[model samples]
Target: MKKQEQDHQKKNPIYQEYQLNLNLYNKGKTQLGIEFLI
Candidate 1:
């Protein structure tokens, strides 16, 4: 399941967008774990 999620994130733009948002969130407030939820 985890591997599939990783592969999906690599191929899907929506996932990539979420990843960017995750990065920004991590940078701004350091929650750091939101990327996985996204």
Candidate 2:
């Protein structure tokens, strides 16, 4: 079940966006990273 969920996220756009967000979050500021959710 967990693996299936992980695989689903791998192909999901929202998840991809979240990954971009996490990258930005890890890079520096919080404001721009939060904006990715919207």
Instruction: Evaluate all candidate structures by whole-model CA lDDT and list the values in order.
Output: 0.81, 0.85
Candidate 1 weakest ten by summed lDDT: 28-37
Q: Give the TM-score of candidate 2.
A: 0.48
Clashing pairs in 1: none
Clashing pairs in 2: none
RMSD over all Cα atoms, model 2: 8.1
- Evaluated against the true structure, the overall lDDT of model 2 is 0.85
Model 1: per-residue Cα lDDT at residue 21? 95
Model 2, 1-38: lDDT tens digits are 69999899889999899999889878766666778767
TM-score of each: 0.50, 0.48
What TM-score should be assigned to candidate 1? 0.50
Clash totals for all candidate models: 0, 0
